[model samples]
Target chain A: MSKGWDPGLVLSWTVAVIVAGAFCWLLGDVFWNGLGRVNWQFLTEAPRDAGRSGGIGPIIVSTMLILLVCMAASLPLGVGAAIYLSEFTDSEVGFGRMIRRSLEVLSGVPSIVFGLFGSAFFCIYLGLGFSILAGGLTLACMVLPILIRATEEGFRSVPSEYRLGGAALGMSRTRRLLYLSFPAALPSVVVGFVLGLGRAIAETAALIFTSGYVDRMPSSLFDSGRALSIHIFDTSMNVSGGEAQAYGTAVVLVFTLLSINLAASWITDRWLYRESIGS
Target chain B: MFQFSSDTILFGVLRLCAIAAGSVLLLVFVFLVVESWPALSNVGLVRFFSDESWHPAGENGLFNLLPMLWGTLFVTAGSVLIATPLGIFSAIFCHYYAPSWMARVYRRLIELLAGIPSVVYGLWGLVVLVPLIRELQPPGPSLLAGIVILTLMILPTIALMADAAISNVPKQYLHSAAALGLSRWSTIIGVVVPAARSGLFAGVILGTGRAIGETMAILMVCGNVVQTPSSLFDPIRTLTANIALEMAYALNDHRSALFFSGLLLLLLIIVLASLAETVRVRGEVNV
Candidate 1:
């Protein structure tokens, strides 16, 4: 350690403290006002009077349903594309490069643009109407890039020696990929899924037009439903005297995201520990 | 023969998925262009660039988007300006000054910041940030409020990216600096930062992209006024916020004009993405 006070050290510490203080302030503000309103009834009952005097039961259901549809659609496509990129092709070359570039561009495209695309293409052109299906599918498009890149990185991190070893054992390519590569990359795959889930659950702009924001418990995938994020947006922005419920809903949303993030980190940490032990 | 055929089938399925994924970008572009075609033709390209304010309805409806475009750029620039230095300094602190355990915890904190929903940020802004700002000035939701919220939202991105960039600097350089009796702070500024310059630049570009694309938080705090902001306290609206605010009730030409704005935002995003990608690739080559 340096003997006395260093000016650079003071400056850097001050900057870090300021940044950390801002984060704490934001988190503290939300939790302090919001946590008191979140309880058992809040988790189980539907809202009334334009979300001013009731709980968020149906909103939770809708959020999960949208998340479900989004994951169901995105996971297979993302894993398949990742497999092709990392295992079946040279990424520096023609088709692979094109796919990579498309994903990079898609990842950066604004969420509202995805909203416009979803409304124009899915709702109107495909005749899906304003439904959970439209909203979930739009989120799927938004999340595909994250999933594909993460899973591709996972597959790439698997040692080439493992594949060679499987071949030496007379295992077929299909069996080797299914048994060897997939298991090895399972941790990263889960991380990607969780990351995508967090993103889909938090989206508001992309879902509002596509999902039609009904605030009703959806009977089927075709029903227009209000997601939790949209509920927060509406209750806070549009509805009058809806601040308390908005705080509660924001708490639920933030709590869900925190749990998801913690779970992802836990999984990755365990995987890394296990790998280090084995080596 | 059976094994070979099975492998071929697997390849075909995976290839199909890849192709489908690749085509989505093209599909988004084509769909936006097609949907906005009516506005592009009816309003004339020149009108979009004109200085008249956005009034897309009524008998004297003006389709000019210059104000909203300028608002988007202004807010993004403001946030980037504030966030870049704070993020870089915090990254430097975490990488070099903090203990390993503290660094790990700090990183988790940043990830948590990144994970919080944007709508929650908007809600917080509406209730807390706007009211606080309102105490300072009359109207709470102004360009300043939007800039402050965006700075908080994008800070984690730049910090994480800069941390990664700083970590990628070779250890040998540090060892040599120490051997030469250079102070840690001086060595960092003289050797480490310049070496990580390209990656830091990429981080700023990516952060700028995120700030530009942010919709809900900006919409809530920016007052949603369709005029050029003369000062930080003046109300303004961004292109992303404009689309979200007006999309529900918009009709005919107005609706198409919103999509045109979306198209413009998409083009801007594409330009930023390619720029960041080029910087990343060049950085790797240099390394």
Candidate 2:
């Protein structure tokens, strides 16, 4: 019987760590060189060098706008689907399980497929064109599966005692769900939103077709807009010498992802810890 | 019903949004049909599936997924070959050898790795991976590059899933094997892996789904060529990368065929994901 650590394991692990280390090195390079490019004008100016006159003001605003629109579209629907499956369905027959599995499949679907569907549906069918509304609506579909699964898992984690006790007191199903179940799962649902937000903010391919990749800031939902992800994509693809801007964009995007994930983890831990105490 | 009241109106809107979930799939099917219809009717479905040429802007000839399909499959198989052994081994090591404090930290690292966006991975690949590939080969963006990139990308998911599977191999089984005077190596290969294969298989399949559908990273690294790669060093395109690169510019039946590619993707995920569901049942719960 072998008792010691495998040298092969250590070697393979070191190789992976070194590769990951290279990634961090690139990040450092970006900060060292790319920081100077990310100033007040850089933030406020519309992509001038690429668009020929500029700041990232429009892209940031557009990204936030898309997030709001996407959440508005996906949240209620996903939560409802989660609730209908978790609370309403008879899991013994596998109906809830089937739907749950489908939701996971949906989560794993590449966003590009969602983008293709969006471009065809919202951009042409709905006459929304390459507008912010079209982009957000497309992403709404993309996030729905994740939201539903997370919400369901959150609701499932709530002990049946709470619901059984409510029922024993003759409370209605709807009443118990709204008053008790929703609050208990509120933390998890928030985690889902955070995940969805990070996804939406980083999304590029989906927005490319539906949102139509405009560089300028928009004042209305009907107007086309670009997000930070699209800005990075545009810089990477279209700009001839905007590697500086691309690195700057990557730093912003990476930081946004890391911070949001951290915040969600903190919220999740804090809520679970609080929930465990006598309540 | 107090239709004009704020609460009633709010409920009405929320209900509409909620109902739209059912419409979500319908919306996808209908939209793909609408966009792809012109192309479909023009070129009968047979030529579309049978042919392999990929000139979207060219005249009269638009059919065949052989190249892109081949490409996607190539990279996927390559990634599977790379990730499976490394990931399974890492999972086993973490489960058996890691100290408790280190296990939690390592697990978190895996989670963080999974959370990084595809585009960021593409960025890192472009800056680092491409150059490394180019140095060894004639030019960059070979299938090798894509494979290595994908292996790294899927490691965290595969590792975490494998660890869950390994952990599910009951402690008593290990102790009993030890009691029987069996070696640690024998216990793992004989007792642990065989017992938890379903979970490990599920994790591998999940990684496959990820590798097959990966778009952005392949778009950046896989040399956008429609050719059968003879070696790992050859630049090739994947079905996903093809769709991403060509979808925006495609017209007519080319468009329909692209949606068909999506349908194909849906079908692929459906199969593996169904298997993954069974695997999920076998593996212990993980967040």
Identify the leading candidate in terms of TM-score: 1
Best by DockQ: 1
TM-score of each: 0.98, 0.89
Please give the lDDT score for candidate 1: 0.90
Model 2 interface CAPRI class? acceptable
- Model 2 / residue B258 / CA error / Å: 2.1
- lDDT by residue for model 2 (B173-204), tens: 88899999876566777888888888788888
RMSD of 2: 3.8
Residue ranges of candidate 1 with Cα displaced over 4 Å: A1-5, B58-60
Candidate 2, residue B49: the lDDT equals 59
Expressed as tens digits, the lDDT of each residue in B1-287 for candidate 1 is 99999999999999999999998999999999999998888887888888366788865568889889989999999999999998898899898888889888888898889878888888888998898988999788999999999999999999998999999999998999999887888888998999999989998998999999999999999998888899998999999999998999998888999999999999998999889988988988888
> What DockQ number belongs to candidate 1?
0.80
Roughly what TM-score does model 1 have, to 2 decimal places? 0.98
lDDT of 2 by residue, A46-65 (tens): 78867434668888888888
